[model samples]
Target: MTTNTTPPIPMDALRTLPTPELGMLLLERLGKETRFLPQNITAEARIAFKGESDEADLLDRVCEAWAWVESKALVSQVGTKTSDFRRVTTDGRKLVADPSALVRLAAADRLAGPMHPALEGHVRTNFHLGQYEIACFAAMKEVEVAVRDTAGLGHSEIGVNLMRTAFKPHNNGAGGGPLADAGAEGGEQVAMAALFAGAIGVFKNPTSHRTVTFDDPMEAAEVIQLADLLLRLVEKAKVREIKTENE
Candidate 1:
């Protein structure tokens, strides 16, 4: 008997692609082998595993999913690499030889279930966004922490005493004028200016109003910007996945 065994790969599970990428892998590897069509795999059965299932059976399903992936052209292998002189093997003229197409093919192979492509793409984009959010949060907290650690030091860079003071809107009668008069900047900036001015005026009168009434981190412009980027990336990937599914 010849020493040949095509290691079973999840070549069929990737049925969402056209004949070029995902399907191409399965077409090349399991060309002659009989395979099951995706139509035959019941949706309820596939979903049932998502709920209640034994661990071993889940693994079997994963393997079955892989086998299906192989069939669907999701994932493919490089074939055996035996170094023996007579045992050597090579692809025949029947297979597609183009190298560039394999990248999408390889991507299709690695993903699972619906939105696989989009999910994978989102994973990349979201990962970077997540890292950026973490960095910003760190920077914001560092200032607060710095103010606490340097209790006595008079450092202008990190405002410890300024943070301790109260800043609130002013509704009292004053020559300075109302909050939304002829010249108004922003609600927050206006609130800040009023609050500081009021604090100075009410310095001797401590029973006037509450101090520092601003929403914590109310202006997450940077975080919001990052979130917007991630949302668009996910939405775009989702649309692509939807298209791929129908294909």
Candidate 2:
């Protein structure tokens, strides 16, 4: 006589769950194995979900859910003689230890989808990992770099001064910076400078000097979005500068 083994979680129930939920379940399974081959995990998942749905379709869903886990950096492909093996990362272990973080991460990703390409790297990664202050700082720092590059300023000019010098208006026989909008009213130009300076001062500078608390993820996401807006403004300024030079 053969005895059947029961799946820890019913495969039928798992099928109805969302990507993050499915990903979490897969992540927990990965944690149990410690190290595994992607194909092997998917094959096992297929067996567990055997009668629940079409075999190919079930395999595709499991692979996609596992892919989500990889995308989020939960599991890393081990670098050994072969590339077929993967191990759960430290972050993945933490998530398995406290699944609440994965829920928070999913919510944050939904709120901050398709972030500016400039911010999609470090800023998004840190934000998803619950490092809110670091994410905010990195976003604002990208804004600072955009301003500096657009204005042709060297590395020595930085922080609020970089923003001021970059956006300083034409006034009192003084010429404006390359990024400054000469066509705009003098007051508007000055306000533009103030905008960049204030953003750097409030969001970026504090993180550099000391530890700043950002307990609320929603507020942190908004701050990163603000940085995205500032980067767009800098891009516009670059185009304006080029147009001014051409004319």
TM-scores for candidates 1 onward, in order? 0.17, 0.58
List, residue by residue over 1-247, the lDDT tens digit for candidate 1.
Answer: 2123232223233324343443344335444433333332333334434433352454355445435444543333334433311110122113345444344233333333332232234433432333323333333333333323322334452332333322222234332222122123447535544443333233312212333221212222233233233334334434543564598
Best by TM-score: 2
* Local distance difference test values of all predictions, in order: 0.34, 0.82
Tens-place lDDT digits, model 2, residues 50-139: 665465666666777787899988999886737678998988998899987765665576555676789998888898778998899999
Residue 243 displacement in candidate 1 (angstroms): 55
| Prediction 2 global C-alpha lDDT | 0.82
Off by over 4 Å in 2: 1-111
In model 1, what lDDT does residue 33 have?
Answer: 37
The 10 consecutive residues of candidate 2 with the worst lDDT sum are 1-10
